[model samples]
Target: MNGQPQWQPISMLPVFTDMIDGMLESSLEQLQNMQAVKDKPHVLDDSILGRVIALYSEQLQNHGAFQEQFNRWKKTGLCATDLAEVERLIQQLAKLKTANETILGIAKSISHATIDKIMAMDDAELAVAFLSGKLKRPI
Candidate 1:
């Protein structure tokens, strides 16, 4: 199989799980941090906000790389054990992708909302409602 992709044991990479978990964790922390300052009408820190955005961008690139690797390996064929592991990893990756998209969507929605709009929300309303489908943006 000349010119074909090689099938290395990629699922064994130490950073595989950590990278995914870290991205998810970072998103949650950022969202929580946003909530903490939800009432502040004029506080937008580019440096702090950029950190989570950068992390999400990196996670997305990593996910794409892993997907490309998995697709290439599909042609090479894994052993029974490796196949099972890869299948499990693929499932986990799918979940992670969904989570990444969800977080990105939240960030995107919040980006459009002005500080005055966010500050107008009552404490009973979730800070994330400005971004989530649960609450509609007022006209």
Candidate 2:
């Protein structure tokens, strides 16, 4: 696998744009395959399944958009309670591959920066920074 991306806080917005682009591109390919199947005759059950998949894909895109916006909003700084919620969302997201909500929360946290920023901080500093309006909103 490739190594991790280098830290570049200022480059975050562009990075997010690229990531979303990549995701949409890949998702479109998967969607095309799904549609090819749907083009065939199907019972109501299969159609329902296809619809569910479509909804999931749309949700994924929505999460991406929210993450970008969240990063932007975070620049306004977070309240203590809001920071706690973000943390909770992060923890919940880490354990699941498809937990889009959780993932989006965490992603939003680092949207304007890199994971290193979060990892380098002690809880107190992180909390203080978050509550002080020093952080940026992402997404």
- Evaluated against the true structure, the overall lDDT of model 2 is 0.45
Q: Write the per-residue lDDT of candidate 2 for residues 20-43, one digit (tens) a residue.
A: 455555545545544443323222
What are the models' TM-scores? 0.54, 0.33
User: Which residue runs does candidate 2 get wrong by more than 4 Å?
Assistant: 1-44, 90-139
Candidate closest to the true structure, highest TM-score: 1
Cα lDDT listed for each candidate = 0.58, 0.45
Q: What is the lDDT of candidate 1?
A: 0.58
Model 1 lDDT tens row, 1-139? 1244344465554465565556556666666666654444235444445565566666666776677666665556677766665566676677767666665555555553445545666866655675565444443
Candidate 1 residue 137 Cα shift, in angstroms, is 13
